[model samples]
Target: MTEFAPDAGFRKNRKLKDALLQHKALSKDGLSERLFSLLFSGLVYPQIWEDPDVDMEAMELQPHHRIVTIGSGGCNMLAYLSRHPSSIDVVDLNPHHVALNRLKLAAFRLLPVHADLVRFFATPKLSSNSAAFDRFIAPELDVSTAAYWNGRDLYGRRRITVFNRNIYETGLLGRFIGAAHLLARLHGVRLQRITEARTLREQRRFFEEEIAPIFDRPVVRWLLSRKSSLFGLGIPPQQYDELASLAGGGSITQVLKQRLEKLACHFPLQDNYFAWQAFARRYPDAGEGPLPTYLRPEHYPAIRANAGRVTVHHASFTELLAAEPAASRDRYVLLDAQDWMTDEQLNALWGEISRTARPGARVIFRTAAEKSIIEGRLSPALRAQWHYDEERSQALNVRDRSAIYGGFHIYGKAA
Candidate 1:
């Protein structure tokens, strides 16, 4: 099979495609649409924001379930694989993401030992990562995946060297977090101190002392007002509005402060890798902080055993779902990609999801707002097929270790 180039992920529904190609005479909506396209053109997420642990809890992954999920940064699929699902159909419209998912699946398959793999991904500064890639992962990659990672940037450094650095600090999302740290420093705050907090009280105290004051700064508030400033967070203009609405219009900074407090103080430093990555800019040393489920040695063998079960596709979720057999898939993880879709897109998506999902199939997704966008948007016929677990969703949202999103929702297909 021929490989898709890194630049090939732009193909989408005609409406979405047209939105991407909006001309200079564009109106407010047109400008917002085009900005969304530009943000997705490269690697948006170095690490995924939707917490997989919470996701697995909502989906209740079973060995018999055939899953389909958006392959963002490929972390969730890898996390899901630890459950030994019967199969996982991973789809993404971003070819870089496609390549990323491919690289991870290939690494789990080709790399000889768990420790070597850990050193390559977790050790941060390990120079031998490129060697590990060349020796174990490169040959397994398709032409496109190999080309993407090996390609050089303007500075002439190879893209593969991203692994040699703190890989978490290397993508669009990473740089956003890095900028946040820079802003905090300008306000004389050290975010990394939260990682040293030995108790929840300490974590709360550090946030009140160091992180909260920075949010009240004029520069930070001004920056938050610009949609383009948040392109690094993988948030589009539409999603930005949803978040602002959640904050009741004029309080984005306060909303962010509350969310960050949840990230820092609500979850333990030892188990909230999202917090570690945000505050410390790196996951903790082994046994110190929570590693993503797939990275832990205990789950390595199950992930490896099940890694081969994944089938990757470079297509939109709706496109792939429309092509699948009816009632064939049992678990759907939409991530927050739906937050970017139009009502037409949402109908098209859920229509196919409703068809492809088996009775009792569970769909879990996160949203920028506290409520799901699915209710009024999905047609009655399509919407009626699923039972929204509102009580559980509200409960899980509070428990989510990755506190970046405002809502965590679960919809179960009626049995």
Candidate 2:
């Protein structure tokens, strides 16, 4: 992990430097890592990956296609498994996410029955549900992942036990939210009420009555103007700048709150798994069970059979593609990773992607900027080989989350 001093030229932009300097100096509060660890540590948690629904549609995944995806928190990867693709390779820059994926895979492999697995993930207060870890899941985990849970936290709490106790709040993003909740409290705003609305109407009512008021506050507006404040949400300097640029100036908070309101007010609490994670920090109790397929009871056999096809690595996307045989994969999911890359990185990644494209292969990615990153960067010779489907890509995006991203693109090798 690279440790960036708050005073350092964090990125190429002067605005970002000013933004970081404006925020409070980095503190150890609840973070697992001290200063250096954050700079050098694996990404703190899984990113908000592109909508799984969007990814499935854009890929037009068939039983024959091999899929490669950045395994953020592993939710979409598990979601993809439900479709039963021929093979799925989930890679991540964070060892923690990789470990999380491995644990999910092991759960699918060893859970004795679907209902048992469902109870394990969907049950309220998982650790208190004693039958879960010892009876059904623990024996399945590999040693490395098992060790992860056994580790100690800053509080010296057994981290493995936190899974049973706090699986819902274990990621970098989760920790960020915890801190945000504290920060919001310090600001004299409350987020707890936002989660209590029982219906979409109720949700919207609450947003208007209880949440929207914060958007107009001077403090909220000030925080929105600074890029460093968003670092707590795991957004890097460049992503913060791009997101700020999207809404122009300090209005970004209003833009985000509006979208979050959509997430809260439009989707049913029962159907919106992302919202469930955000608000309640747990899955709904429907018999259909927790959202991800790897968390599902019935999918284990197939997931285990397919798990071997995955090889988790702590490498850049470009580096992984370089090591692969040409034409080795049929689908690529870049998620929002391009937003974090430089022009040279994007070109090199695209270069290898072009070389590795099988006939009709498709590459998918989301951008923080509204336009596709490849607009004029790729050589015409390379660009000509792949077809960009703008309309279809636009249609795949879910409204609430799509509002946060500039573009969702799919490039296919033309037949």
Candidate 3:
């Protein structure tokens, strides 16, 4: 099977470089940034980590609304279609993600049935997936997108072969979870044990007895201290600092443990697919546990019917928004992209968002730390155009099934 060369044209991507490169080339921080950029240059998120249910609730998505969002892993974009939004413009700096988003859209449109789409995306080790992609998905793809899947890696196999294996286990986030599982196993802790708990009580017991102890290990603490160790989580150095700050002068491992505990205990395993991916590696077998909204059999019809409403772009969110007319878009989903931006970038992003926002337009994003990162960052005038719903944002943050992010924020364009 072909492995993706994640950094095929990484150096030439100025936007990515601008977002990631912050320190001198020979500096310690600089190397970590470069390394993360390289890994991120390929497929980082096989599945987006943010919970779309929480996102939909926060944004109050409507059928007449036009949505613009950062297209990470593309699941949420499809998930949003359940609300029947008029259109979704998805932008990303990584071409691999753009290609993946397009591939998912094509799969939804052309696959013969819901089960066929499931087999192609969710089933692992299915040898016929590549054949299905070739026959159904490839012919309809635009030239560049077709070239992306047809393109070969260092090994002499097409990129589409990733479908035949576990697509969830192939990207940077997948590898990170895989490594975490391995590390847990090495310490005689099976993280998957948490998934076996049928009740929240059992979940907490499993976390306390089995998973929590691993954080106290000297090696585990040392590993957590290194910013490079988290690159697989798609966390750049800037975001890592925010996560560390959340530790509040305590061990970063404690923060990780708390987040993991929430993931294990806050939601029932049967209802949270994010927990399944974290512990079980693949999504639950059909009808056994929850899947992302886009992958649920019931949501399939709606997503397929509305798949054409999405347009995928290989550009930054701010750049894409900059091209739109004023007061044109009604919803924005930034994911956690802002956690990586500089103050100047944040101002530029809000400037465009404020300009393009329709009346009552809502914006939702996540943060690495438990507070809104935009406070005092956006220029005062730009900030005044929006109202931050502090109580609602905090309420929703606890409800985010992903449990990886510290804050889930909601802002509304001031009427």
Candidate 1 segments exceeding 4 Å error: 1-25
Task: For each candidate in the order shown, give its overall lDDT on alpha carbons.
Answer: 0.82, 0.64, 0.88
Question: Which numbered prediction scores highest in lDDT against the true structure?
Answer: 3
lDDT of 1: 0.82
Where's the lowest-lDDT run of ten residues in candidate 3?
1-10
Per-residue alpha-carbon lDDT of candidate 2 for residues 196-237, written as tens digits (9 for 90 to 100): 666778878876876677677897788777655666556666
Candidates by TM-score, descending order: 3, 1, 2
Best by TM-score: 3
List the candidate 3 regions with Cα displacement exceeding 4 Å. 6-11
- Which ten residues in a row are the worst by lDDT in model 2? 1-10
**What is the C-alpha local distance difference test score of candidate 3?**
0.88
- What TM-score would each prediction reach against the true structure? 0.94, 0.82, 0.97
The candidate, 1 or 3, that scores higher on TM-score is 3
lDDT of 1 by residue, 6-81 (tens): 3332334343354344335388766876766755666767677888888898988999999999988888899998
Model 2: lDDT of residue 396: 64
For all candidates, what are the clash counts? 0, 9, 0
Number of colliding residue pairs in model 1: 0
